[model samples]
Target: MFRISQYLRELAQAQATGSYPTPRERHAKGPVVIWNLIRRCNLTCKHCYALSADHDYAGELSLPEVFTVMDDLKAFGVPALILSGGEPLLRPDLFEIAARARDLGFYTGLSTNGTLIDAPMAARIAGAGFDYVGISLDGLKPTHDKFRRLDGAFDRSLAAIRHLATHNVKVGLRFTMTALNAHDLPALLQLMQDEGANKFYFSHLNYAGRGNIHRDKDAHHQATRTAMDLLFDHAWAAAQAGSLDDYVSGNNDADGPYLLQWVRQHLPQWEEALRQRLVAWGGNASGQMVANIDNLGHVHPDTMWWHHDLGSVRARPFSQIWNDTSDPLMAGLKQRPRPVQGRCASCQYLSICNGNTRVRAQQLTGNPWFEDPGCYLSDAEVGAVSTPFETPANKHARRTIEIAHV
Candidate 1:
């Protein structure tokens, strides 16, 4: 994930001579764990990566088991933990687990649908001292409700955000972009400003679980570029106006390169500095900086890889599973200059975006090394030149020279 707002601000304020500061390097000890405490959700979202339903899954970890995992994470020096779910608040011990995580010195965050966060619940969450709360709001009333597969969901979620704000809880909005909701982005940004949201997380749709069914509906290249332009403009303007503090994009590392290009064209002076900062940030951290532990304690490189299990916490500890490089996928993911195929292999900005999202490539092409189908950059943009540089006579001379050597 790239925090474009913060990076842009840093670049705008930085001195010309010195390099900007880098974010804390991840995966030195353990990946930030996105623990799915439960798999049951009230609403069936159109692009739900989990395909979570209203019914209970059979093998969710118990409270004691969750405590055990939390203890292990703390011991392993995991920097942060995000409690996610079909709807995490639906868990009976949600607050208790959150409190326990805090007690153990974890930077705990909550990811929820927001419809379940009422006034009293908001008060409880605030009192629990969660580091942050991210609530999903896809778009305005009609669009959001349709995406959520329920009417009145938009009003209820908006009410929840207001309630959380009233309680002084640090809350952010999570919006997943697709053809259905891309048009609503401007209105949604205005809503964020009006609602006084602390942050906005923009996610590009990834093909997984229920999302795979809607792959055709993913935003086209132009739409994606337009959406990103809107987000950058709003976020940059908000920073200048001293409104929102954070704006991030996820599920696609191509965003980093895209932002670099934007800076090159618009704010030419900051281009070099921003490029250095992005290279240090190192995009696409799955299987390295990020990991997912599903409701059943199965470990994956990321949330979208629910179908591809690396290991099981029930059988072995998370630290053990994450550190075991014998697994081919895990090993390849941690390698520098990853063995990626097609355009991603030859991208000029490979240092910034480490092969984009491997899961997307795997999902679309049935080979994880293939170019990510979700990458919105063009061949020219990514530095893919089909024709060879040498002429036919030069090529024949080179072939003759190689034959002499053979």
Candidate 2:
């Protein structure tokens, strides 16, 4: 049953990403969604969008709320769900939640920091009937420890990975880039190579959480153009080399939009459908996912909301900043600290890029998404942009190595 859920999810993702319209005119509303089970975390990392576990989470959503959310999600026809938290395993009710989601027939899964993933816990997670397990692994031990701020975390995570690997489970990796270790892209990428990771995602350090704090700012030290380009080039090469074929995905404005756009154009026929799927189901689609729970409680069509969340990169919020959609949050970020030179406006990639993250701009120049004239990335956006580029981000792709910050 778990295997079937994963297969279906992947097939749906591949189909949706291929630019081909669904065979069934009435498609599944969502393939997956993230449940921020609780905003509590065990680690205090350098660049966390959720910041530290400092937020008041004493009043976490009751099991009833989870059920309500699941019911709503069922209504929207969402199929999969990822239970997350500061560390989802930290929640004493984890087993119950996982079992319930699975009972509902949803492709249930959990994303964790792995600190609390003991042998019993791992067994329970598997027994709970989740389809896949996503573990945060920024890099190798040294690099990972530096970024995550937990010395033995890397080992614990490896244990969890090995445990999962030993099971009939689908495993994935998460990489969050930060300024502190921006220079070790190659080494970080190496970990991905070594692990034979099924699906790997690299994320830009978001300007939220502890990330909102000054230490989280990597805009100045972080690799923008050079790193992104390198990582893209490397990943594409790796893909062709047969090392990775699961298909990498993420929501970094710095790379995702440009890369996705480039990929779509080259693979034209499927671009529209893929983009629409991404735009509608990406990170910002949480609201829609919340409406899809069925009565008997079998979940289907889980939505990976990242692709859908960043609908626009220049819009404002209707309510408070925190409550706004990822699209508008990203969009509104671009307008801050207006570009110094008129070059970006005239640049071809201007329309595609999110002007960099709001905090990156502010961290480097006190303005969100404002191009730092001194940075190579800011200049390259307008310079190398062509009608089409063979690769998404060669520099970025190369700079990345296996480390675990995200």
Instruction: Please tell me which predicted candidate would have the highest TM-score against the true structure.
Output: 1
lDDT of 1 by residue, 268-330 (tens): 877887888888888899999899999999999999999889888889999899998998889
Least well predicted 10-residue stretch by lDDT in candidate 2 = 294-303
Error of 2 at 340 (Å): 16
Instruction: Tell how far residue 99 is off in model 1, in angstroms.
Output: 0.8
Clashing pairs in 1: none
Candidate 1 minimal-lDDT segment of 10 residues = 384-393
Q: lDDT score, residue 72, model 2?
A: 54
**After superposition, which runs of candidate 2 have C-alpha atoms over 4 Å from their true positions?**
1-32, 54-56, 215-222, 241-244, 247-249, 256-380, 383-406
